[model samples]
Target: MTKSTFHAAPLLTLCLVLWALPLGAQKKKDNLQKPMAGPRATALRVSWLYVSADLGAQKVGRVQIGREIVVAEKSSDWLRVFANTDIEEEHTSDAPIFDTNDTPPPISGWIQAKGIVIDNTPNGDQILMGAAADQEALASDPRGPVNAARTAHLLYRRLVEMFPNSPLAAEAAWRAADILWQLQKADSSSRPSAKEQAPYLRDQMDEDGLKKVIKFYPNTRQADFAAYELLDNKLCGDWQGQEKCPEKESEIYEKYAAEHPESPRTPQALYLAVYRQAVLTDMYTADNNDKKSDAAHNHARELAAKLRDKFPQSDYTARATMLVFKLDQRIPVYGIEKE
Candidate 1:
């Protein structure tokens, strides 16, 4: 046969063989030739997690795809099994063919792109949704919370820097703080203090930090409470034993009352002031035996008069009035004897 004819004959025969074998059979043969990982079937490692949902109506066992999220605490969906490792692409084969360089095929592209939910609280959805822009920027790629938080931190920092005067800037600042705090909390190496955890709370602050908040957002509702916290912290500390305790407490009350006369906590501030004065004066009189003493007599009389006149409706008013009358009865031999 001619060279051209001989080649054409083989090509025709090849076409016939290709056409004759059905698609399904060819696919089956290909699958059969694929090498398998080992004798055991490829299966993921899974664990059962106890879950309470439906107000404890349904107790379920779940496999943890990732971490337990706070939001999941209330979810009705009982269980989730997740893939731990990549799946082997090799199938069962008769021939012992080994490819040392071949790697397992990764999971479905989309399932991984969803990443893992951390907090899973009511607010979690918002945080995740907010991250969509970021996820898209990373080329539909995926990573864990640690990397996600780092990305979020960068975004918030940029937002804060770019919009310094905007509320969004403040929010971003808080978010950045929260992300750092969360990362620290998630780390098992060390624990953080209440003060250290304050940043993660987002615009919320500890006592010292609240002072800064009050200063920065003076008219804000948060500042109103912050101011009270500052004053409460000061008053409840060492001031109680000092000679100027009553006076300092009184000054704080007056200032707070003046600044926020209509505030709900105004009564509380006033009560604290009056209480301090009454107690201190009582201590002074009880300590000094001499009724003729100027400091004791003057302070006791002054506080009693102040409470009766200024805070008649106060809870301490009735008690203070009786004290004033008692002080009146003790005014003998001071050149101003009681009638």
Candidate 2:
């Protein structure tokens, strides 16, 4: 055989292999997005989870490729699961974490069962959907009353644990913190006083957890919430009678606002940043330390003024106006005296 003829045959064979690559790649992508419907279903295989078990059910949400389902119940083709933000709560009162009657309603849904690929558990098509689907799905559950909210929080934690290296990890972690905060407020509304609510709020949404979310997913929406929550939320300590750590709140807000100039979070964060600085002044005066109050008052005023000029139309601007007035007139901040 002539050398040129042999080369032509080899070139044709290579061309055929190259031609098939896209189809094979596409098939793999589809498999990762959803498992083949078979005799048994596994959790975390479907990309777009159906609202119902029926194959034709409308898409209600998505299950991340690797999110673990507690799987309270399952049919041959579908699994029932829950998803949400996870928050840590400490028992502040003798009150059962919640009244036995108040057990959070289970947030439940159905998803097709799929299989796990044990050998390729950590990489490739399993990791990216170009955007974070499972992470978002883990968070996508509609905010609900305490019961459903609690379940959703559990789901977030599951996603984080099951896919620690996935891009969605930050989102899952943030949702977990957010849910716990919401649950905390709900639990406390029925209670009598700050002393009573103090315990419940003490350790909920630990500071380090929020910091980790921001550290890993700095520009994501989850990070934005984590950053803001670390300041304005209890994660940074806004209560009294417990180990007080409210002094650091203003610094976090200022740093977050400065770092993300155009972030939507910046407007609100700047406003709260100023609010918390005034809080320090108020706290000092409340504690009978007028000398310690002066620096915070000055800084708060500067931040308030900056907000007034930079974000005149922000939702927090009116509050900024009130902040300036209070700082100047030395009006005792309404809640500061007691809290």
Candidate 3:
């Protein structure tokens, strides 16, 4: 999923070609005459990391200082190192967060060992920053939407699995789950059935990754949107393991409305609860259970009325008003009278 607009800090530049070539051409005067001649040492400040200990090796990326790293297995003037990958997640808050976290494999490269110091303290943020660099580069590729989404899903899932606590983890999970729902060729003509959904959607990951964001990280902004996806228009069949519109589906919406009344999402919850009940009436009607259908219709009418009275200014008010009339008409025809 694309992040909502926010003032994000500048993203780290790590991809080899996109970043190194331009900088390499400009810094000729300050370039080291030769590789450092000393014992292996940790990178002290922001410096270029190379694919080999030799000064001539391909430049992979630059690393932030204070990232504890191991030495090269063989002797060389350069220090061979792997990017750190232990970033901790952000703290829970009601605030909006827009950054994404990626946890792909670390980029291995060598750096000049001259000013580097001997140290081994790892920083979670550093590891996470490196991951973020790799994922962003892959995502920005000009590959067609279908192909790009497929590749992004892999990296996003890795971020979620490797750094569940990072602020970006929730966003990554959201993207991975959302992409699967869009893989079909929608621009063609007709909508496809569940089987018609991307062939690998179910294979990439289950629905748990999406739902867990609400349960495990409710305070994060991503959970609110994730909840919306889980309850999409009251259809919980796609949520958790429910095969149909289970009772729990409506409960989740109503509960979200009651608990997060101050959230901008509260109106959506209230409105969807009315919709869910209305759909249930249709389900029973299709099953030829008139009594149940009337009962459900009346219940939906009650919810729609409540929605109208509680938030008359909301756009849902117009829909809920019509819903009340529609369900009211059906309720009486099914032989249900006002109590």
The numbered model that scores best in TM-score is 2
Each candidate's number of clashing pairs is: 4, 16, 8
lDDT of 3 by residue, 17-120 (tens): 22344544655646423322222233434678777677777888766543434453434656666553333212112223422354333456777765454423
| Candidate 3: regions farther than 4 A off | 1-50, 53-80, 83-107, 111-212, 231-252, 255-266, 282-290, 329-339
- Candidate 1 lDDT, 1-339, residue by residue in tens: 211110011112222333345466554555333322111011111233332223334323332222111111123343222222322211212212332245221211112112343322334334433553353245225554434555555444333322344444444444444444444434522433322322232232224334434444456555565566556334423332444656666777868867975555665665555455455554454457344344544654565555566666776556545544555565332123334
Those runs of model 2 whose alpha carbons end farther than 4 Å from true positions after fitting are 1-146, 154-173, 184-201, 204-212, 231-247, 259-263, 279-294, 334-339
| Model 2 Cα shift for residue 201 (angstroms) | 11
- Between candidates 1 and 3, the TM-score winner: 3
Off by over 4 Å in 1: 1-209, 212-217, 236-242, 287-339
lDDT value, candidate 2, whole model: 0.53
Residue pairs in candidate 1 whose N, alpha carbon or C atoms collide under 3 angstroms: 35-91, 36-91, 71-120, 71-121
RMSD of candidate 3 to the truth, in angstroms, is 14.4
TM-score of 2: 0.45
State TM-scores per candidate.
Answer: 0.32, 0.45, 0.44
lDDT score, residue 82, model 3? 54
